[model samples]
Structure formats: C-alpha cells, structure tokens
Target chain A: MDERERINRLRWRCTRRAMLEMDLLLGEFLERIFPTLGPAQADAFIILADMEDLELWPLINGSRECTDSVQAEVVALLRDVRVK
Target chain B: MSNSSIPVRKFDAVIVGAGGSGLRAAIQLSEGGLKTAVLSKVFPTRSHTVAAQGGVSASLGNSEEDHWHWHMYDTVKGSDWLGDQDAIEYMCRMAPEVVVELEHFGMPFDRTDEGKIYQRPFGGHMSNFGEKPVRRACAAADRTGHAMLHALYQRNVRANTQFFVEWMALDLIRDESGQVLGVIALEMETGEVVAFHAKATIFATGGAGRIYYSSTNAFINTGDGLGMAARAGIALEDMEFWQFHPTGVAGAGVLITEGVRGEGGILRNSDNERFMERYAPNAKDLASRDVVSRAMVTEINEGRGCGPNKDFVLLDITHLDPATIMKRLPGIREISIQFAGIDPIQAPIPVVPTCHYQMGGIPTNYKGQVVAADGVPVKGFYAAGEVACASVHGANRLGTNSLLDLLVFGKSSGDSVIEDLATGKVAHQDLPENFAERTLARLHRLNTQTGGSDVNETRLELQRTMQKHCGVFRFKDMLAEGVAKIVEIEKAVARTEIKDKSQVWNTARVEALELDNLIEVAKATLVSAEARKESRGAHVRDDAPDTAENPNGRDDANWHKHTLWQREGSSLSYKPVTMTPLTVETIALKTRSY
Candidate 1:
C-alpha cells in the first residue's frame, strides 16, 4: 500500500477504537445519571452521540487528518459529559 | 489536638505504600476485620510494581515433580550466600501457598490445558545444585507483575480497604519513648497536612531506582519511605547492592522484560553473533542479571555494540511467531512503540543496562518486625515490600524473586501485625514537635529558595553520574569519585528550588519532596558501594580484579559478611553483616556460570 493509504488505515483503526470507547463511557454515564429523559431529548442525545462518534472516528482513526471542526465536536462531547 | 488545628484520621492499621507489598498487606488486614487505609503518592495501578516484567518464583504443581527445596537452593545460590538462611527457608516453604492464594484471588496466571499454572525457566533457577535449569517462575505471559498487582488491587476493592490516594507521608509520628504512633501526611490536591493515628504502620514503599537517572523505575519510585525511615534513625540494611536489569531500551532506560529472553529472544552484536556465549557458555542468554549486564557493557566498551554509535546490542525477537509475540508481549510492543518509536516485529530493539531494584532497605526479621538502629525491635512499626529487606534477596535478587518476596513477606507481615494487635495494648502518645518542624523546614526550603539550580537538572545530573561510575562495572577509585560527585550534587540539591509555587495541584512540590528522598537514598548507595572491597554478585570491583583473595585462605569467606552503612552527619559508618542460622547445609563456593 501507498504511505497515504497505510496512514489512513492506521488512523481508521485508532479512531474506531477511540470512538467506541468514548460512546460506551458516555452511554454508561447517561444510563446511570438520567435514565428517564424525555423521548425527544433522548433522541437528540442519540443523534448527537452518533454525530460525535462520526467526528471522532475520522481523526482518532486517522482515516482523515485532524480538523478544527472535528476537534471542536470531540471537545463539546467531552464537555457535555463533564456537565452531566 | 484540637479538631480545627489538627486534621485527625484513624484506622486500625495504616499501610504507607500502595505497591505490591502494601496492597497485599491491605488485602489481608481488611479481610481479617481491621479497618485498613493504604496511603500512596500515586494511583495504586501506576506504582512501580507494574514495571516488573518477569514472573514470580514458585515451585507449583506445573511439572508435578517440582519441589520447594529446589526453589530454596536456587534462591540461596542466586543471592550469592549473603541471603539469611532462615528468611530464605521461610519464604521457600511459603511459596507454594502464596502462589495458590494468588491463583485463588484471580491472578490470571497463564495456565496449561490441564488447568495448572504455567511455569517458565528464569535465569539462575536450577535443579540438583546447578545440574540443569528448572521452570520455577510462575508467570502471566511477560507482564507477571502487572497481572499480580491488578489481581491484588481487585481483591483489595472487594475487601473495602480505604484508599488515601495522592497523599504523601511527610513523617512518622513517634512518641517520646521512640514508639511509632502514626504519621503526618500532605494531601497532594490541597497541600493540607493531616495527622493520621493508627495502631500499626506498615511501610510497603517500593525501591529507590530513581536515585540513578537512567533506571527502569517509574517516576514515582523515589525511596520516600526508606529515606523517612533512615531519617528517623532506622539503619538501612545492605544499602549498597543495587540490581541493574541487563536488558533495558538503550538511552531511554526502559526495561525490556527478561521474559523476552526467557521466551527465546537472543542477544546479538553488530556482527550478528550470539555474544553471551563468549561470557557464559552454558547459560548463554540465561546467565544471571549481574553477569549479563557486565557482558553487555564490556561488549560496548570493546566496540562490538550495535548501531553507528556502538552503544547497545540487539534483542532479536523477529524470528518468533507473530501470534506468540502478540499474546505474550502486548505491553512490551506498546511500550517499545511509544517510547523507542520502533516496531519490534521488524527490527531488533536496541537494549542496554538500567538501574532496576534495590536489594536493601529497612532491616526486618522474617516476621516483618522493623529492627531499630541499635538492634532493638521498634514497637508498632512494620515493613514489607521493597522498602523492607527481610534478607530474602541478599547481595543480589534473582529475576522473579521480587514478586515472590512481595507476596510471601507481605502476607507474613500482615499476619504478624495482626497477632501483635490482638495481644498488645494500644499505647497512645502525643506527636513530637521535632517531627513537624523537620518536615516544615524541608517544605519551606523548597518553597522559598529562589535561586541556585533546578531540581530536575540536579536530579538528571545525579542519574548521569550514577549510571556512568557505579553502574555495570565499578572500581574503588571510580566509586570514590562517584561518591564525591554525589556529595556535591546532594549539596546542590539542598540549595535546589522549585519554580511553581502554587499550593493547588502542585506536582512540582511533590517532585521536590521526591528528589529530597532520592538524594538521601543516593548518598547511602554511594557510601555503601565504596565500603565493599571485593566483587560479589551485582557489586563488582574492577580495581580488585580477582574474586579470590589470599591464595591459601578459604574462598567466599572475606565476602561472607554484608556491608551496612549508617548515615552519620555527612559521613557513613560501616558495620559487619550478620550470618547465622545457616540452614540446609552451606553450598561450597564455585565459579558462577550459566
């Protein structure tokens, strides 16, 4: 494989693992703290979680190089966890 | 003490460290219905015990033919006859039970298809008095210490032992009668000093590897408990003999677990020739740590080393199956990648010698009672772990003996303390003024000193000096010069100051305190290294070329006694080693070979 292709593969591996762990931790936290949030809020949380995972997936997995939007999204997700 | 002025806490027993020994002791103490508290400077998982990559020694039912007697013989021989026979015998007899107990506690030891704990052959472990090598090391792949510590911590959580994390013990509080009453500790988060009173105190603080800069120790292995004990007038036993692991990542000083070699990784020079064959023909890659380390250094000195700089040899594991490497050495690969920035699967990882473990510390009996400076038993004061030497590992420690020492003695120390607590009455005394004053003086000096040198720079200099002079090979003149340089560094450390002065989350202050401990322990090591005249085990003397002295005289007799150093106001006093209770018949001295 080309260097770029190799790097992309390695990045994908990293991002996939990071996103998976982050989602698991957040899901566990939400379940523990607020298990009875309204359906719309819970739906919003799920969509946001998916979006956050997608953003983290690229950077951490190294499929796509890190970008300001991706970094901001990850930071927001982390901050949300802290606030909760 | 008023509640406003004194931050008072109480426990049935307070364990001063959170490494293997301390965690083991806490598990026992709490399980036995005592309220135990483990005070540590870092998270229990981050302790240096996690750095131990080899296995714990035990003669389990793995081979069905293994016995504890063979294990004891290997231990005695490994220690080069300086190990106390009584302690060695006690440890050996208890090894099987300890191993079984760890398995019961879910240690995750590698198992055979027959559901038996898998055992591996480590250096110097033999059968029938050096006839053939034996599989005595009970391991969990290569990360045995990691597995063992994780198991102990898990079991400890189940026992509900209170963990006082990130709190550094500043001083042991003793009454006017010299009985250890409690300790005063500073919380790392707030810099708040609190006085903790307990019925008994156990120092399970690990080794002083950070005293030398280029060591395989974690940043936290500062010998704090040993320094505190020494300052409290405790005589550190065999303070001179430090073990340098033969295979560490060159320049970085990260340990490449002996398990690699135990699993068939060979050491080779730049010419791709097996080098250990020249030094230890029979043992080859499995010679004792002291011999292997010296051989590696000699190769480098003779310009047979690998790389353009000719600094290190190659630890070749590329020939091993990928599946085997992934399963047994996951952590090793991760570390090599993180620190050395190399992929071990394709390249030979560069390796060298690094300061690993201390073979000396607070003097204790088999029961883990702390023997005072004057040979009197200190009441309510106990020691286990690397901080306390029950003399199991005398002149040199074998590859797997450290974990064994922690488990065997950790259990014994707890049991002995429980016995004392059951029978003896609690003697209460007021905290000494001098204790607080001395600790405050140190804090003040570090906090206020605005000039001189950075603590980090001075610490780095100390490590460089030790790795250069007192490492692998040594001579009297070189040792003397090393000691003199260390003394000068100690002075520089005294004047050394920290840059960050904030009381909140002040890691700099903690580093300064740790550096102070490192300096005191380093002084002890240098002084003791210079006092010993003959080469034996890890403490080799290049000036005294021959191991033999006085041709008509008995061999190993002059080197029979252990070297003891006592800190005496900027100088050290030497004393004779105790050699009694010789058990299982003393083996004759022979040339130590693989």
Candidate 2:
C-alpha cells in the first residue's frame, strides 16, 4: 500500500477502540499527533493499533513500563494525550 | 408476486433470538421431537444473556426459610400493582422447579456449605411478606446468566436444535387470516433473504434498552421482535415502563449488578452516608430497582452526588472481605477496574442510573401466546423474555427475577406449542400472495436511495431525544415535546441510507435496518409515557408526586391499565391489568413502599 493509504487506514483503526476511554485517548492522539508524524513514528503508531486493549492500555496509561524501544515514542505521545 | 423468488426454509418451529429464553424454548421443542430452527444476530452464547450478571431468583430455601407466597408478594409489590396477578403467581410458583431443572442441565451454580445452590439477597425479594430481606436469588457467583445461558445452549445442542447464527428476522410473516406463519429473515453473511416457514414462531428477542443513548444493552439489542410485531399491526403493551438499573458504572454505562449490594455492598453519597437509609428505611439498599434508581437520581439532583460533576453516586464494597469479593462478584470487580478504573476490593465504584431493561413489549399471556388484547390470542405466535410483557413485570422488574421469567415462560411456551401441534391442527398456512414485499422494498430503498439520512446520526438523535425528554424523571411539557420530536425523527429513520451495498458481511446494512426497529421502540416509549400522567413504578413523572394522602402517585382508579401503542398511526389504547390470581384472593392495593 502507498504511504498515505497506510497512514489513513491506521487513523481509521484508532477510532475503533474497544473501550470508550481508549476511544477518546486514541482519538485525541489521532487528531493531534498522528498528522505531524515521521515515517518511523507512523510505523510505530501502526503497530500500537493492532495490540489488544489489555496490553495497549497499560502502555498508554503508564501502569506498565514500556520495554520495547519501537513503541516508546508513540506510547509517550499516548500518555501525554491521556494526561492532557 | 411470485412466491418462488426468495429461498424458503421449513421447520416445525422457528425461534428468533437465541438468548436465554430462546435457547430454553428451543431445547424443549427439540427434545419433544419437533424440528426447530433458532436464529440470532450473534452467536448463541454471545447473546446479551451473557451480560446478565446477577442470579435468577427462586424460593429454593437453600440459604434460609423462604416460600413461593413470599416471593409472589415481593414481586406484586415490586411491580407497583401493575403486574398481572395471575402471571406473577404462575412465575413465582414455577421458579423453584425451573432453577432446579437448570441445575440438572449442568448449570454450575455456586453452592452452600451443604452443597445446595447458594442463594443471594436481591432487590425486591423479601421474607415473611416484605418484613425482611431474603436469600432467594440462586447464583453461580455473579455470572449466573453466563452459566445459565451456556448450560441451556449445551442442552439444546445435545437435543440437536438447528441454529442459524448471524441471521436477523426482518418481519413476522402472517397469513390472510392473521395467523403468524413464520418470519422473513435476512442472512447477515450473504445478505440473502429467506423465509422460515413454521408451524409456530417464537420471539424471544431481548430488551430495547438501546432506545436510550446510555444503556446496559449490547449493540444487538435493537428490539427486533417488538418492531416486527408492531409493524404487523399488533399493539405493544406497557411500552412506557422501562427499568433504569440503579448501578451502571458512571460515564461508562456498563452494568454493575445489584448482586454486589445483595452481597452486603452499600451506596454512599458525597456526604459518605448511606442515603438509601432515608429513602427506603426498611429495605435500605435492597429496595426494588425503581425505588433505588429514583433515590440515586434524587441524591444527584439534590446536590448530594459523589462525583466531581455531582452526577453520580458511589457503590462501596471496600468493607467486604477480599475473598468474598472475588468469590461472589469477580465479574463486577473486573468491570469496575476495566470500565470505571476502580478496584472494588479497596475503593468504591462510581455508579449512576442507566437504562437497563424493558419491562414491557409485545403482550402475551402466561402460556406465552401473543394476545391481540386480554383474551384474544394470536395463533402460532408466541413471545417470552424481555420482548413479551406477559405482564409479570408490569411497571418494574425485580433484580434476578428477569432470568426466572425467561425459564418459566420460555419452557411453558415451548410446552404449549408441543401440545398445540400434537393435536395435528396446526399445519403450514398458505402464505399471503407477497409475504416478502415490504422487506424487499425496504432493502431496495436502502440500495437505490441517493443522499438519504445517515443511519448513525439519526440513531444518535433518537437516543439523545429520548434521554433528554423521556429520562428517569419525566416532565409534562418535555414528554409532550418528546412525542413530537420522536415523530419527526421517525421520518428521518424511515429514510435511513447505507453506503455499503456489498452482499458480504454488510454490518452497515444491518445497522440501518436495526435503526428501523429502534425508532419504533423510541416512539412507543415516548407516546405511551406522555399519555400516562400518573407516576407508577418506573414511569415516574415530576407532576405526579406521592403526597401524604396518595402514596406512590399510582392512579389505579384511572391509569391501572396497560398502555398499548400501535405503530400504524401512532395510536394508543389501554387494557386493564389482571388483578385476580389463580386460587388466591386479590391482594389489596396499598402504598407501594419498601
């Protein structure tokens, strides 16, 4: 898929959260941070979308420490959005 | 008007909605050696019955001394005298038998020290005739409905009941003589239209809580059966009476079962006081759901609410032992931590009243046959569960009694069908010249339309309008305006368009059709609620307050009858609530207090 097509698909996936709280948190992230993304950051955001809420939630809420370097930047952004 | 166009499947009985009630009914027909087909919009177990967290009430006397008479009295008083006495007596009398039967079907219920089914205290269940709380709700921990639905489904499978998963019933097909033949259903996978011709059609469709924006119902609860029956020129009875569960998680609308309170949890306000002590001095937190919900809402409105917005209360279970919390209400703790972001073992869960169950729908007798009026029965048609008002839960339903209602009525309906068919009197009725005409036209409109109303937007408007105007507290002007606004919204819903024209798993198409059903329920609720000026059970109006002289504001002399709403011209009529019980004297009406 083209880069633009991939980014748009990832953005749509953000809207489809299992939890309503996650919907708002990810939705805010999609609107504010997703557009001004570098290729690496966009790819990092892509992987986070596929993770289940049980895993993805702790990373965003900072309940569990993020060990993976790839997800570190996106997870930090999600945490920022949640606190905001 | 060719009859050979759409595919047709035949069965001795077709049951719509494979929830607790439908599965119970299906097991009976299948075990009776009748060919049965059960259709559901989702998988059988995933049906909303799995979402029921509390126990089913039965006078098992497993935990303490109890009797069916006490159970009957509690239910009658719980319903605010709106419940038909005969139906309530039948349900209460049959409760113990059905619960034991469910146990025999391999339902793993929580047991006492002596290995009897464990019973929990629930709202509106009393001992010695409302003198004290009783342990009558037989539970499998807090997930009684999940255990019950799985056990019933397993039994149906053993009996070889054929199931049509992901199929939605579009409309009830009736013959020229007004006998229900079967249903026109849509196969959700392929978008294929098929008619399930049957000797009997059972609508076990669950609640219509989706009519409100904030609800405890799953997305599949669109009130399909009620809508189909209404469109076929049938009246929906007691549509105004809706039960707002006392403790849905604040802001999330996920249900926090009353089972927690039944297990000795408390409701605290901002003042950190048990406010229910003032509202229902005797029953306290274990009052009927309507009473508890109204108390919570009153607390919020009176500025005693707990949350920052002062819009919610706190359900405190921190006083309970951790082991008891885990053993009795594990699902509640999970729901609280996951949805409300609180651990009930340590902290209180934020809760508010949310639209939970419908106490009314397509009218039926205790035998489960859909009735045109009081005594006029519709042949070959039956309904149970939340979809059919059998008038057992007339104005309000007690906690745990809903599950009991399904077992008692669902089994009885199935047995009645067996008896009816055994006489060799019921056969395949000739289909009207074009039974599928309306369904085909509806689909054609969706496919061929250009720039019609958006499905989601219109549905949101309907929910918001219902929530705003016809909320927990109803106002005279607001309800009148609500009727007009909902009538306007119905026009837009009738024009709801879908973008997805694909014949493959088109959920958009399914959603638009569900909107059609949701609008009917919304209209019926608003129209019936507006006409019923008196406050009775769940349909409480601000204008109708309980004064010193007139307790509960129940205008039995005037509004004692059921509000029947017809979809044809939005017309409404009333039928009297049956007062006489079988072989028992009438219980004198009095102030309905906890």
Candidate 3:
C-alpha cells in the first residue's frame, strides 16, 4: 500500500521476464529507469507491468500505439530507453 | 576477532545438494541418530533430479522375465567395458532393494495389470545378455525423477533432517593432516560465510552439463562438489566421457526422455527412414545413448536430416496409440508441446543430441568413499550421485541406471558414515586458524572488483568453445585446439567479475562462483579428451574408427585405464579399472555393436 513498497514490487515484476530480451531491456536499464520516473509515470507504471511480454514488447517496439492517455505517458517514457 | 564475525556450525555429517542422492543420504544420517545438514542452492524438490523423466532401473521383473545378471551384463557392454565391474555388480544387485524401499516410502510407481510395479524398456536395458529388450525401468509414468525426489524429501522431513536451502558451498575444508573436515558455505539471505564442520562430508552436487552450449541439465547442475574437490587437490576420474541424450528438442535444448523410444517412439530422417537400423541392427531406436546420438549426427551430416536447416532428426510417436502416449509418457508430450511446439500424437518432434550427463566425477569406491589416485580413501570424504564416479557408468551411462546409482550409493555413503561414527574415533579435528581464508579471498575479490570481464559473456564464450570442439565426433587436431582454447578461457574466467554487489540474495555472485567450477569441468573434459587416443563409450574420435580389428577403436592395451585429472600442475594420471565383481564372474569385453 505504501509508495516505496509498491515501487519496489513493480521493479521486481519488471526485471523478471521469461524472454531474455525483455529482461535485458527492462533489467539492464533498471537503475536508470527508477531514478527518473515522474509522478504520472510512476502511478501508471503498473499498467505496463500488467501486460504480458508478448503484448508489451510490440507496444514498446513501435508496432502499436498506447490507446489510454495515462498509459501512453508511461509507454512514451519507456520508449525513450534503448533496449540492450 | 576476524573469526568471531563468521559463524561456525557443527554437525555429524554435511551433505551438499538435495537431489535424490543427497536426500537419500540425509534419511540415513538423520534416522541413524546423527546430526545431519543438507545444503542446496535450490529447494530440495527443484533440484535437477526433478527433471529426470523416464524411470529408475530395477530388475524386479514386473512386466516380464528379468534378472539382475542380465542388467549387469548390459551395463558392462553399454559402458564399453570402461565401467569398473565391481561397482557395476554392486549397483545392479542393490537396484531391486532400493526401488522397492522407495515404493514403501510412498513413491508413485505405475502398476501392471496384476498390480505389480510397471516397468518399461530403456536404452541399453536388454534381456538374456543382450538378446532382446526388456522392461526393466520402473517408472511413475514419465515423471519418475520428480516422484522419487518428492518421496525421498518427504521421508527426509519425517526423519528430521536439517536443511540449508538457498545456500552455496564455496570450498572443501581439510585439516593439516589431509583429513577432510567440512565445507565453508555462504548463507544467501544474510551473505554470511559459515564453516559447517562435520565428521563426514557427502558431495551429491550432481553433474555439470551446462559447460556445453546446449544441455538438458537444469541451470543449477554446475559441478559444485567436483569443483571444490578438484581445488583441494582431489582427482577427477574418467573426465572425458559425456553423454549426449539422443532426443533434446532442437534449438531449445529441452530433453525429451529416452523413455519415449522405450514406449515405441521411432526416430526418422528426412526421407522418413528409421536410420538407426543401419547403426544398431538389434536395438535400433533402443540402442545405448552414445550409439543413438552418433547415428543422429551422422544422419544430419550426410544431409538426411529433417527440418529447414537439415540440422535435426524427427522422433515420431504417431504410431503409438494416443491413449498409451497419454498414460505412459504424459511428461514427454507436455515437453514436446511446450519446447518444440509439436505434440507427439499429432506430429514428430524435432530432435538433436544435446549434452545430458557427465559419466564421470570424483573417483569413489563402491562404499561411496572418495578415493585417491593410489586407491586410498580420502579421510572422512564421501560422494554419490552424478558428482561421484563409482565408475559404474564407465564410459556411457544407461538411461535408468543414473537413478539407481544415486539411490544405492547415497545409502551406501550414509551407512558408511553411521558405522564410522559408531566407532567413536570419528572426532572433530581442530580447524586451521585460517580455514576460511580462501573462501573470504574469493568473496572479497567479487565484492571489490569493478572493471573486469563480464561474467555472463565469459560463460557464453566458454560454452561455445566446448560445444564447437568437444562435440559428438572429435578430431585429433581439433581436440588439441580445443584444449588450447579452454586454457585461454580459463584465464578469462579468472579475470571475470560481477557488477552486482548487494549483500542479500546475490544470484550474480552465485553465478560467478559457479563459473569457477564450470571452468574446471571444461578444462578437465578437453584436456582428458585430447590425451586419450581411443574411442570408447561416449568418447568417440573420428580418427580412431571402429575397424574390423580395432572393434570400436578401444585401445585396451594403451587406454583401458581410468583418467585422473588433477588441479595441481594441471596434470593427468591413470588408474586401473577393477575387473572382478563383488560376486559372480566378471563380464568380459567384446566388440560392442548394438
């Protein structure tokens, strides 16, 4: 329920993925991503975490656009970080 | 003051790894009224033993006429006579008793129509001394290893065995008198290094198949025990022979158990021809692992391979009834679907031989005591499972024999420990003041080092090198080159460092430690493989062809003995194989053609 605990939980979920490419993209850029999260991006991060790698990778990969306004803000932030 | 910071724990016995063998040994040690500690990097059930599909070998003769003698014969022939006969006889004779005991411990064994434990034919399990295939593998469907681990762990819990889960052991501790004390381990949660002093130390750390680029082994099978032993100047026997299971799902390296073939699955080439008939006439799809693996590679090399790249063959179980596949090999079907994206009942699974098991490790006697190169037992040190070479498997291991080796030798080590304890002479020796120095130094290096070779990249290079050079077929110059390449890789391993330095639950730190162990295995394999000129068991070289006079190119005159690789000076020595059995006549060697 606390903000710090929720952010830590989101970090754990983001870093661990079945596909290595997703793990590398999310996990390798982990230190950089967490420190720079804006308030709006922080609140909407769970929406991205909820999506499976099969659905999420393409969205971050520029194949599709985020439909929801708050979700698009988080996706735009992630799209800036280069995948390893 | 320095020693005060590190906690020291003492037990009557400490067993590394909680696979089938470790749990089996723990049952005896704890139940026999001795304090026991079983340490594993993973949870007890999640160990590689859980990945064992197929079954355990037992000559209960449940399905048809069978005898332990025939099992011993097939084992000797299957081993290509590299396995010590005494150990082979001991394991075979003890197989029935162990399997039955496991059943009594609530193991879920499949039953025959008469309500007897069901058995299936596995590769190299023949009846009447290689006359015909026999149903000798006692299975719980295809999840035999999983069932066995659960059954054994449940028993261990009831026996009140102490478990150290998520703990990684770093080094084997031996007193100044050359008597083994115990190991210095790291508690993953606290990152505290502790010395687990014990009267007896049993290493059941299993095999290191991950040294190869593609392997069927779980990620945790990193030869931890072998590494610690080797670093402590212990000799590793028969390091050249590694088995390639005939059916790993191509590209994914997930194992499709040999049990599939035992249940009437067939391997076919691009032309839909059952090509094993040409390599092994009598056994065909049910030939020993090495023969089957080689035949598949040869088929692929000659361009008879299936799939788009023509790099793999096909394992077809379409002919088997769907009901039977569902009943007997449910796990195999699940793996085929999950890994290869093909269901066996609908289509053939793409298959290639991938590194599966190490047929060698720390040399031990039938009693599970780790032996020196001169045949003397190392004081208070014991080993079982894939980490110990009782030399029963010799050059090539049979399918179900692995589970048998673990259970029999696991109990053997435990019984030996209890008897040794009963003598009242197995006292705890004084630990050296600097017992934890080597362990601390390694940990300190990992913690402090910042700029160095990345751990994962170095590991990938090591695996790719092993896969390229020491594969199904070997060449003289190629193996020599591989040896040189591995020597360079070892240097890279030494320089490799981890970036993650957090104190709690550091998996990256664990991986770096495992890499040190993997390099030892990779070096031993390549070095021993290059020196041995003969083709025996899984170690077949193209230069030494199986000619009419040569008969599988086994140079018995020159290379019949076991190879002992030493860490000091990176040297290799030879030891004679025990030809006499515990009881009955020894099985003589002949031209081994399936």
**lDDT score, candidate 3, position B128:** 98
lDDT of 1 by residue, B271-341 (tens): 89899999999999988676788888778767989888787888888899878888898767755654465
All candidates: TM-score: 0.79, 0.82, 0.81
Query: How far does residue B119 in candidate 1 sit from its true spot (Å)?
Result: 2.6
Window of ten residues with lowest summed lDDT in model 1 chain A = A11-20
What are the per-residue Cα lDDT tens digits for candidate 2 across B1-594? 245799889899999989899999998899999999999876687677765667899998988899998999999998999999999999999999999999999999998889999988986799999999999988887577778888999999999999998788999999888899999998865678899999999999888888887677766678999889999988999999887877888766777777899999999999999999998999999997767888887787689998677878999999999999989998777667766778899999888888888999999999898889656878899999999999998888898989999999999889889988998657788787898888888888888788799998999999878876787878899899999999899989988887768775666788788889999999999999999989998899888988875577778788889889999889998888899998677876888876
**How many steric overlaps are in each model, in order?**
7, 0, 0
Ranking by TM-score: 2, 3, 1
- Candidate 3 residue lDDT tens string, B252-315: 6767877889999899999999999998999999997777888987788689998887878999
lDDT value, residue B267 of candidate 2: 95
Off by over 4 Å in 1: A1-84, B1-4, B257-292, B295-338, B341-351, B547-555, B570-591
lDDT of 2 by residue, A3-84 (tens): 5444444543454333334545666688788888787887788788766455687686566887677689888877666312
The C-alpha lDDT values of all candidates are 0.74, 0.85, 0.84
**Candidate 2 segments exceeding 4 Å error:** A1-84, B1-3, B246-251, B256-352
